[model samples]
Target: MSILLVDSYDSFTYNLRELIERATGCAVFTVHNDSYQLPAEQDNLDRLISSVDAIVVGPGPGNPEQSHDVGIIPHLYSKYTEIPILGICLGFQSLCLVNGCKIRLLHEPVHGQVSKISLQGESSLFAGIESGFDSVRYHSIYVSEITDNIVPLAYSEDGCLMAAQHVTYPHFGVQYHPESICSNMGAEMLSNFGELVQKTGQKRVADKHLLNVQPLILQFSSSKEFDFQFEKVSRKETLSVCEIGDDFLLLNSASVPGKWTIIGFPEPNTSQLITHSQSSGLSVGVWKGASEAVNQDLWPYVSRFMAERKFQPRIDDPELKDCPFMGGFIGFISYEESAPQDVEPITSSPIPDTKLCFTERFVATNENHTFVVSIRPNDDLWIADTTAKLNTLNPSVSASNIPAKIEMPDKQQYVESFNKCQEYLHSGDSYELCLTTQCKIHIDNTISPWEVYKSLVSNNPSPYSCYLDFGDAKLLSSSPERFLSWDDEHCQMRPIKGTVKKDSTMTYEKACKLLKIPKELGENLMIVDLIRHDLYQMLNKVEVTKLMSVEEYHTVYQLVSVIEGDLHGSNYSGIDLLKHSLPPGSMTGAPKKRSVELLHELEHQKPRGLYSGVCGFWSVNNRADWSVVIRSLFNYEDDLCSTASSRCFRCGAGGAITVLSTCEGEWDELVLKLNSVLKVFK
Candidate 1:
């Protein structure tokens, strides 16, 4: 059945569309009262009014008389006599005028938050309404008395006509907007109208013209030979797909108008998969309708695409050596009646078809078991497409894979860097930078370089801290906060500054003083200013919603600040924010680009990999929430180590320093923050 939602303003029309869609689960069309264009052709309009199951005239900000000027009410009533029609606010006034009711202008029109309504009798529109209920009212003019064909169904406390129904016709009108949330039973009222349409079997205006076919399924698998060919092409072309989970993540980065859309599966019935847990991060998309093409064509292309890249393990880097392969897993419990005395087999498996392969190999181990798994691109990317084939095969026996462990550098360099930082602090080159400014420092000496490489994937990440091991110099940090996260519309940045010692005599005043240091304050203010400027470029009405505030957290106390604004007219993507505001303000200090340059000069290192980057999900709604990669550890396995003994961890920390900063104090701060994680290690 068709429903016409008439409005005089665009906002009203937009809202009506959403309300009607939600209420009826049916497509609805809108018409503007003042438009020179009518809905469809003139002949079509007559047929539409005759066949339409219902018509809903929406409320707007203007006077009800304006609706007559456009002849909207007259036009609707002239052709349709028996159809169920409901009017709201302005529409109600139009209904009253057409039915010969008196329209009286009030000194102050009731507008929002009026009073309760009292139902008079068994009315079609008020079928489910109880005697007394609160509802929003908005109008400058109201109907004073019932018209000839209209029968009053409800009234306001002051005798104002709140609702009236046609005595003989199926027409209904209300002086309040039942489409708004403020209305007591708005959805129920709309749903009642929908039910009437269904019961009457009213001829519906055809809408098949708007229907479109669903897209074909695209699948990937690991058993196809063509997958290897595709891998060769991707590798030769230097295509890069994100290696998330255990599969080689592949995307068409080179496609023109490059857009990667993921459609998730229908909601699963499993309670474990349905819950919101960090262990079971939400799935991206779901597959539907199995097909031969999905198995043969799509799977191979994915497998080949993943094979083209090589994984590079950074042996010298501590963060990589200890990085954990962070991804969610789902377990299934199957019980057989024949084995009633035995407990059902409970097995854990990664979410299907969500795996991505890194260009490297990592030693994977579950619990106490360990084994080396080569994560190189499968001969066929189709292998990654496990949802279809794997489910069809019998479940595997329960057994844990042994993780391989590799040797990494020892505590000698870390000890040396720590001692050097201490010496600098004593020399008085600078005063104490905040103690929380340390970055992750690598400590293990036996993890595979590739295992470290795999830990950079930013899925299912844990809070970690690490010290960057750059032979001659080191950069340390203990970050457990998100720098910035955004989807399409809204963007957020949680900048962490200021720090207090965990076991020190620091009071709130001392903590505030530490943050308020001229150098520290200046640096923080600069970051705020930079963030404001960045947001200004993307958002409208930019404002410092929340200025510098002290937010006490579990592990430490931080001086945090918030800056926000609406995404300006432009449709900004999550990747846009990531590229613009990365390596967090807390880590980079004020004058971001300059601080980074100084960091590069003062600290000897290249890219910090995932250690300093942001990690979070960018949802389809164009919204996202991510945390800065800090207070976390990455774990890699040693390939040479026996299955029983191969796992390591890497933690990091670092602080912003200005020329006024004392080397000795900076070193001490780094150590203090580094201890925040090392203590967890012990």
Candidate 2:
């Protein structure tokens, strides 16, 4: 069977698509609700609907009362009466509204809540499915009054309508998300829909214009050889890469759980890859002297840059193979850097939206395990000198209280923004809004950027902590969230949402007890669904490997979840997938586009800068790793276009404001996030 799932811009649309494909073992195609309305797309749209055996109106944000929100959905059910159809959430409400029922706003909205839903009566949609199952819901509106045509098939524990079916048509609807990872028997529900499709006896030919499938494995290189080819050094001695330097990167994992670190620095002979800026078009190879400029946007530009990476031989050392960053591009993508032209950044940026470095050599190490250095051909003398410098370098970097002042948005201003976010949440404009505020700090330049990075890691060692010195901008990050990472086989994303302060009395058990409730987990759940949607494309199957687990950090306990999907053939490159999933879902909210739009109005146009952006490396090998830049302080070279005697630094902090969030509590959380990094100044 071929199913055409009309996506209503919901985060879980892909989740539903995968579920149907898994349950029915059929080819499924999808299109955005407003996708084909254009005059040029009408014929293609008609051909698409005619090609599918069944149509599923996917759930999404907003009310069915608004025709623009639901798009061609009303026409699909009304015009194509003989075709089997299934409506979910927004789709469900759309079905009810067309059948002469009203979508009423819930007095108490349930954005990311789980509840028991019991079957109402005998119905083909619920046949063979377990009754009274826990299903995840992400809706703020409902349909309670059923007329003769609209019949309730299931109801929640509190008696709100959960599932319904049309008495005279092959149309069905469900209030809860059947495709949620946390929801039970989702496959069974989709299977029942398949059976209903069969009973309808619709004989339709599959569409020839199916979406092309791409290969998962990515392979491409600029040249057959790099400035330095992989070779082994004769001497074996552990060295400290902690020594501070200019235009270098340290992916520090010191004291962080189950982590490795990489120190990336440029070799003089390979100076072409010092800095990356997307402000203007890029010239491909300055080393060649007659290089050509590439006229592409940020993400596409990255894809080409990575595709043309210099080649390096494989290092068999168990240490180097496991580390994803064996030395490549190291830099930060500013928060608003990749925002499409449609979404204008509120804050005027102080620096280019992006800054990256291509390091020729790097050292990978784990304190207790192994230290592996990348060796190139004809560089024995350089390696010996570097090894000697690292061996004799002092590892101890003491913390200092160097006086610093912090600036912030006042309580009233923040509270007002918080209140506005609440209104948007209740009105269904967004499920959760990540409201952010930037803090400025004036610090004495007596301390170097590398020393400041050492202080950050010393104060709050996090799994994704790192330091970047790009000459123009220096980043000191102690972020704990892994935004996205990929190897040859699969792509993984770990999002950190909930936060709890750590004290002497806080135990792992206590943290779990305090952080596992519906209110606390709701924010995390919305982002989880959003990320699943983001990654659902080009996926064999996505899994929530770790869900809602409270992990301890230096200053706080956080609720983290890991979601991963296998990368398919060369159809999509690592950069392609990374760019497709921009803005990091956790930093945004559910129904991401709308939430991002609403946040523009709520955040008062303050630039998030590097905060909430991602930083890491894309290796010469087809692999990459990045961490969400958070809990960090950063500085751009002053007006002199160089580091000054005193530097002006910025720290960004924010909290996800959901319907359950209180203005004061959110303010406190924002303050806590800010203090987590600012304490390094002490």
Candidate 3:
């Protein structure tokens, strides 16, 4: 069986595709609603959807009345009357518009909330599904009145139309999302639709249908038969990895529990992959033996490079088993990455849009052991030298004094941006926006970058804490959020959204109570749904292993959720998911593309640079892990800093702006985030 899903440019289109595929055991393909079908003319539609057994008009963010918002959908409905169509959310609203029914705005919008809906009568779509079942909804408009051609199938508790079907055609639609993790029996609903297509007896079901996929827990992979050329002495407690090399890249999770800490040196003149609009072509940085980027896209070029090195680990030590990466590329991608991928960032910054370095020799440390490694399986000489150099442990040195005070973002500037953010929210242009601001910091030669990272992590211990010394510049991070990580073909993303200052009055229970409110919960819930959409492309089912729950960081309490998917389940690999879901959804709010646009105007067209960007590694062994650069400080070399007596750095902070946000409340959040790193200084 096969199905063709026409996307309306909504983020959740993949989620619906996954649900339908799992329910029917059929292959499902997705294409944009604006996908070159001759703009509502049937010249190309016939050839486009000719082989599909069913058609699903996926939900999106606009009104069906606007032809552009739902391009070529009304045409599909008019032309394919017997194809067994299924409409969801916005798709449901369109069915009414074309069938002489009305779509009216709800008294109150429900963006990420669940409600019980009762099935109206006998229908194959809801055949075995019980009435008064719960389903998650994200709609502001609904079919107000059902015409004679349409028969009502269900209604929400608030008396809004929830589900309906065409009286004469095999068309079905539900106002709520049947693919949502919170939605009950959604797979069954979709399976019922499939059986309807099969039975053709008022679309009767022969027996029973079931849907399944267990949520995966993110686990650090263990190494097997990893033959070490020499034993690496354990000295991580007293000796910092920085003491071994002057120019290095490190993902240090030493302060955080149950995480990998990898440190490696970038040899002078190492192979690099760099991209910027200023460059002549992406091929300029391509590795010697690798093919040049096609039309300047680095995605496929990098994909091929990784494919050639799909290395398998050779670690034999049980204590050294937990480290995911033995050796690979460690790098950063600017929030608005370079051309071929992005048009132009809101504003340019000192750092390159993309900078990655290949490191073949490195040391990986877990909770119990530090493993010295080289990518070459038989490089015995290099291993022996590295092992000897790491034999002695030395104590970490502290800075002479706090470098300097910060130049914080002005309160008035934030107030103006907050006002613009609210205007968009109230106007319905966006549901939530992750508003952010940047500040500057100065440091003298008295303190080294390593000392600063040591102090920062000591003061604010976080799971994703890191320190990178790129010689001319450095990054000191104490991020509590994990952006994305995958071992083999399984991938996971943990997004942090809602934040509350950890005052003395705050307890775990109290924090949970406060975070459960609409203001905080809405911020987190919207991102969780957006994440599901991002993972939909990778799997037939994206699992929420851990739903929105409050987690305590050093200075604040954050609402965190774990979303995981399987790459092997679909045609996509970890690279595909990573490329599409850039600038993490939690950092950029709901309806990502639109929120990013509004953020530009609200942020005064300032580039976030390395502040909100992710920094980590893509290993040669097909494992990837990264952390969102938050509650941290970033530095990039420039002439101003070189001439000045002190080096300069930038730190960013802000919170989600919703209708519930206020000048005073958001101001407090901004200060709290900045202070998380700033407190390490004077």
Candidate 4:
């Protein structure tokens, strides 16, 4: 196969030429500028172009907007629809320009800089590479706006689009020079592109209208509709669904059967459930795996795994781009990831160490709109056909009338646990401790998990509420506390510490009572200080953006505080932040590490799986947001059993115990926090 290397004279052309030749195992045909040196004009140009199997557009000087500078790009782009074309820097910008995307001059042009580039979703362009890695960047112009035609593949730490691919063709572009000597694993990137060309030889470009399947989006009006669709779709054994805010995501695997894998703890690797399957669906695994490596935490593992697979139609919709709940891992991480070394080691837990799912059959729904995205290979038709089917799903069924009963530790037991926590606080062994206990509930199999989620959310209406149908178990949470939220520019953590049940008799009077309580303010301040310390460890400049603020939820009023900081450097990752500041301070207590240790001992060494953990999404943009796992219920049903009709369902509740905390008062707080969850049974 012949390869064409177009030079833009940026002093790296010759090196790029050699790299392409080596990667593709073909002799490079070099051309300076757009014009061919052949004696004839049109005929020679055609002959030179037709001789090549693939094209690599090398980085160069000047803005690609100047048509004269890179006029050949648009021409070659229009002509070479079949062959694979890789664009670098200037060529990358030109490709975006030709595709109706906007370009802008960077205020600080990247030159000889080594920056971390996070691969967005998955692409054949970056197969076998980690999610985020350092790459050599040298450019003045960048693609400012990505149109629908271009699917962004990667981004830099500063949120600049670094790599992208055509929506319909095998055309890929990178703002950084993969041919540069400084780029990490530079040669591997070029080789992957070459292999893609060889593998997809001589196929005619399909019509965009018939071939490109628009993303399927549907909306549900009421909880009844949401429940009906979930029950209908989840009848398929391999289907999954999740809820975020008012949105419900129904991910069906029936169209492309067996395109999923289920994994649990002790092993972090994916086991293929369907052999010889090429359809791209999702890899949903819980983070119960044990890892000695400090950096390979749950968030990092999910991000890396999601990046390794090449799912098709990897576009981030502008409307839901900021919705962190889309398509990455959505589940819980145990407190163990950050638990103190001295803590009684949690040997086993009823819930997985962590549960995260990587799905390309993404559905984002709310009260208003439902957006469904299927990235399965050659399944565009399936995606289009399913949209109407999803919308037309019957909502004839009403909420289940199954009887449910709640089981919790008796009042005496709770008082004893409360006194133990206060003793530690009074003795100065710990300043404050978040003592928690699990409440078990037995509901008839006929009771829909969806109904429970519906009842809790309707009553509580928390901002961070979510429902997860994790294959083995169902998780329903209405948590008001934010574990953390990170974008490319800043990192933020919001902790909810103080809680007071809403009093109908009083309005401002209730707010004043909660606001004036020294115990409440002290609890909030202690965690704030701990979180600030955590941020100081990983961030450059830490600040408490909001402090001791009262935020009212439907069931109760809470004292919340916000802490933010700039990421110290690009080297810090989501996993790093999670590792340093995990088991969120509000959940653990003042002096996070020691508090966790004391609680582990105090709670009978029982692991808090999915309880007091976190449930949220890690985005493809190298950003993530998670909610502290509280005010939640976890259900693990046994469908495989022949005679078993009952399932294990548990909900967790806790209160911060300080020296001034009364035993009866702490018990009251725990019950108050659980009212929303318990009211579902009533």
Local accuracy by lDDT, each model: 0.45, 0.74, 0.74, 0.62
In candidate 3, what are the lDDT values of residues 141-198, reduced to their tens digit?
7788879999999998989899999999988888898877778989999999888766
Residue 435 C-alpha lDDT in model 2: 87
The candidate that achieves the highest TM-score relative to the unseen native structure: 2
Query: Across residues 22-55, which tens digit of lDDT does each residue of candidate 4 receive?
Result: 6767656667555643234657666666666788
Where model 4 places Cα greater than 4 Å from the true spot, the runs are 1-300, 306-318, 336-351, 366-368, 375-379, 396-402, 637-643
Ranking by lDDT: 2, 3, 4, 1
Using TM-score, rank the candidates from best to worst.
2, 3, 4, 1
User: Which regions in candidate 3 have their CA more than 4 angstroms from the true location?
Assistant: 37-41, 104-107, 144-149, 199-230, 270-296, 338-350, 376-391, 410-416, 419-429, 444-447, 471-473, 568-572, 639-643, 659-663
lDDT of 1 by residue, 43-139 (tens): 7566546655688877654455554433466567545777778888777777777788877665434533335788888876667768678776545
Angstrom error at residue 356, model 3:
1.6
True-vs-predicted CA distance for residue 183, candidate 1, Å: 47
Q: Which residue pairs collide in model 2, if any?
A: 214-571, 215-568, 215-569, 215-570, 215-571, 216-568, 216-569, 216-570
lDDT of 2: 0.74
Better of 2 and 3 by lDDT: 2
Cα lDDT tens digits for candidate 2, 27-121: 78887788767557768777887778899999887778887888888878787777889999988888888898876778778888888989877
Q: How many times do residue backbones clash in model 3?
A: 3
